[model samples]
Target: MAAEAARQAFRGRFLHCLPEGGGGYRVEYLEDGVLVVEGARIAALAAAGAAELQGLDLASCIDLGGDLVVPGFVDTHVHAPQLDVMGSHGEQLLEWLERYTFPAEARFADEAFARVAMADFLDALLCQGTTSAMVYATSHHHATDALFAAAEARRLCLIAGKVLMDRNAPEALRDSAVGGIAESRELIERWHGRGRLAYAVTPRFSITSSPAQLAGAGQLLRDHPGVYLQTHLAENPQEVAAVRELFPEAAHYLDTYDAHGLCTERSVFAHCLHLEAAEIRRLAETGAAVAFCPSSNLFLGSGLFNWQAFAAAEVPVTIASDVGAGTDLSMLGTLVDAYKVCQLGGHALPPLEAFYAITLGNARALGLEARIGTLAPGSDADFLRLNPRDVPLLAGRVAACRDIAEEWFAYQILGDDRLVRETWVAGECRKRDGRLAVGN
Candidate 1:
């Protein structure tokens, strides 16, 4: 890597997604481009030999030979405290949570353990080329604070909040309705809009949080505008049935959250695999986003996500790695699973569309498109240098590709963390040569 400087440039093949008319996206690719970074923002992006490159410090530019430079991935939903339990024996959603999720989250009550776990979690995310994510922390306020502090130290764009679960969970992992709301309020005041950190009022789910707790979470969102709301929705049939039994008066599972003013533009619901038509329309009406966590859904035997329905409704959708329940942390691997899930539902996912969903689409869902998720000038300088030929199988497959889209598809199908050569966050190299370069 070149020496760090206030003004620096990197030359590579660059690609980014642009929103098209009619709620679609188009890919913009530059064969030989120079990305100029000044401070923490992108100053300029131009062809290597274009006149715009004149007067620039071309001699100091670091050239990434034949590598692909694209915006870093933005994971819409992930759990920071579940790193230790990833790939645990797959069971249904409720059973898995009780068996594996709760115990793993219980350890976060220890501040020291939480700090170390949060560090490892962030390192894992950076290694997988994820620069921005909406993360879920355990119910412990101190642990949530530790996560925010670590992310602030690294200057990462991370959104997280303490879990709010007043019932249907072990005592060690539950918080009272009033207490949870108070802690969340404090976290939002301290972390929201603090540098690159933000807070999300997280309710574990309808099954875990009492009615009062859910209402309190909504009040928290009302009290603090721009803070995010994240929770589980209709992921499993059993879970859906449970929600129906829990809230008999509500029209549907989504209605429970909606009644409490939790269905705002900033809210993100994960694993909405079994939503009804009315629910879909309501999501569209409220501008709430859904996180399509394919890996977790598949691993937990949850129903398939109705991508076609959501797309038709024009409700925002973003891909996510719901880690722990999810099989891996790499978004590339997650995309592989996403493609398979879509295919299983007879809707094929295009390569460019998959890439777009992880980058600009996700940022747009989170309402952070202006700050991150693109190579557009003035956006944060967060990106990845990916080498499709990182492994022999991937290299051979890419070598036979006739176009950029084919090459990208091959990478998604065969690539993993090894494909990421470098990850840059805020113009600083956090991972280089497939290893973490920054201290966690």
Candidate 2:
């Protein structure tokens, strides 16, 4: 990759979704804006050709014409290895795991396969304008190591961990509780806090992990502060029932992880579709974040999540592809599914709110909003330059837009990876015109 200049500026139609005092997003769209980047941070933003950048070299300026520049999407949850079996269907959660998901993830035990998959995954992430993601890998430590190396090479802000599954999994895919914790510790030692890369202590879920391993995972968090804890939660009814059968002593599915001290601000629990009122209240009280996987839930025939109830309960929520089960990597696609999910729940998710959930909202869920999820001054220079008129349909839609609100809603309903004209990460342009940028 070509070295990024010490400082640079880009001129574009800028957009950032700041939180409103109530429950929605406050959208700021600048028809003509200059975004200044110094090192890896967003230095400043001013009107195009403003006095602030008067003496800067013109060679350092990236002009996006009429394209839209917004903060890069933050996918709070995705399975990096599961991208291989993304389109497979016809089974619910448990049956799906046995038939397709586990088999596909087991392939990551091969080092070469893991590297290739992670490389492609990161490329897919960048091409679609995802700059930061909290990802999951297979049980193999070396394979997880390979994923970290691929992400570090790309300078992507990634948080990932090796899956810890001790029982009820295929023998080839399982590891003992003691061994799994040891493997996770080794990985955390090597990769945690390295550049923009962070680590998550991932105990696959209660069905696959033993109590000993869960406690070990909790201890791992206490041992290492600021590291994250990620795992699946009440994604499906059968999964929740299995958790009940397994942990008969616990109060509910959420209690399985909460019993392990795994419910905190640093914890990310994916898919609480089966939660009751008490569980939602507990999530709000415990400060844990839920990764609402709308697409995956729809594909698996999991129950519709009550978005309004979660919001009313004040439980922190972020969006995810839950890829493989989710069927797509596009955050726009996730937003699309989210919109439909909310519609089914009789709650209308405005386009502005949907965009916020994927960008700043997700960042806030991870406690990283100050560093990312915005074009706010001093944040990372990670964002996407999108042509709202990239395709014929979008072009027509853009032409008909009465205002920015209409344009935003139309894009969420119609956009995909093709809408991403360029993806910029940490002051460097990584993808342009739906492909890797020249240097990348």
Candidate 3:
């Protein structure tokens, strides 16, 4: 009886996504849902009045009545260290890196500062209802280690790696090609597959990493079978031109990385705003994914992403905050920018599709669809409870909504952190009533 009593459950209006034919998804909503959690995974998700709830301890279930429950957001491309630089005066991608990003990252050499910043960064993500993320730490190996430590302590399903840059960066932040790969290997040995954490071999992008470092990064991926590769690609026209000049022999920007064996099934490229048609086909062929960072792209004055073109090419596309460069950390807020970006390209993003991108779509891009993205049985119980009526204006607008789709669109356009009433991670309450429940 005691063991059975220990199981956790929640009753609410649940929403999630299910794959349909033709690589599209359909929304599934249970108006009066009962989500039963055992240990760290969901045991059952059914109607409140379903037979599955007959003998369960509903008396102690967390009743989130009148609120919307959905899977927590998964951010595919964000810089954990760039939290300090977010909302700074926006500059072009290259100048922004030199002006704001590099200087801020230089501070991470001190492990103490890195620990504190990483703690705050993770807490901020939870506050914004982000549960899982692929993060980039500074080149300081100890700082990267601190990020992994903080994430492990919180039991987050996080994927991160230290930046690898041997040239084209500030002197203090650069690491030798040999040294960078060795440190990444050590970090991988120490942290990969530990609890819910994974490692990504992150080369800061072709502009920053030399040929040797990029090749070494690819080698690390081969050596560590399940490890991931994350980096930027074709974000700005200037950056693209520079890559062309630097890699004269390569076919294109994507070819530079592909030549080094960096394009793989687990690789995730961010801000592919200027990818050629050939590059798009190659991304699909290699099973690589793209992180459509709309907020960052718009903020940096980068060209608009052709969302329709990517979809037509069958390339896996996921939404990301891309903070510092990206203006907001809330995936809902990010979707607002994404909607506008798509609109600029003559295709509006549907509300359900926007929600799916931040949740299951992002998860599938990271190869984590079976775990953190859904409320399906046996998946990790990482989810959010959102209150559309958190503010007076939002309440008024949401009240006029005709259906769940309209309400969701209203939330996406008008919502911020306040919409997130609670953020639960692996069945543990991390944020309650829009505040951090755990000590920082």
Best by TM-score: 1
Q: What is the lDDT of every predicted structure here?
A: 0.90, 0.87, 0.91
Worst 10 residues of 2 by lDDT: 51-60
lDDT of 3 by residue, 1-440 (tens): 22443587888899998666666677899988888888778898988778244776666677887799999999999998898889898579999999999999999988899899999999999999999999999999999999999998888999999999999999999999999999999999999999999999999999889999999998998899899999999999999999999999999999999998999989999999998899999999999999999999989999899999989888999999999899999998899999999999999898988989999999988878889788989899898999977867798999899989998899889999999998888878889886788664
TM-scores of all candidate predictions against the true structure: 0.97, 0.96, 0.97
Write one digit per residue (lDDT tens) for candidate 1, span 397-429: 988999888988998889999999999999889
Show the lowest summed lDDT stretch of 10 residues, model 1: 51-60
Model 2 TM-score, 2 decimals: 0.96
> Could you tell me how far off, in angstroms, the CA of residue 335 lies in candidate 3 after the best superposition?
0.4
lDDT score, residue 263, model 1? 99
Q: What lDDT would candidate 2 get against the real structure?
A: 0.87
lDDT for 148 in candidate 3 is 94
State residue 162's C-alpha deviation in candidate 1, in Å. Answer: 0.6
Q: CA lDDT of 225 in candidate 1? A: 90
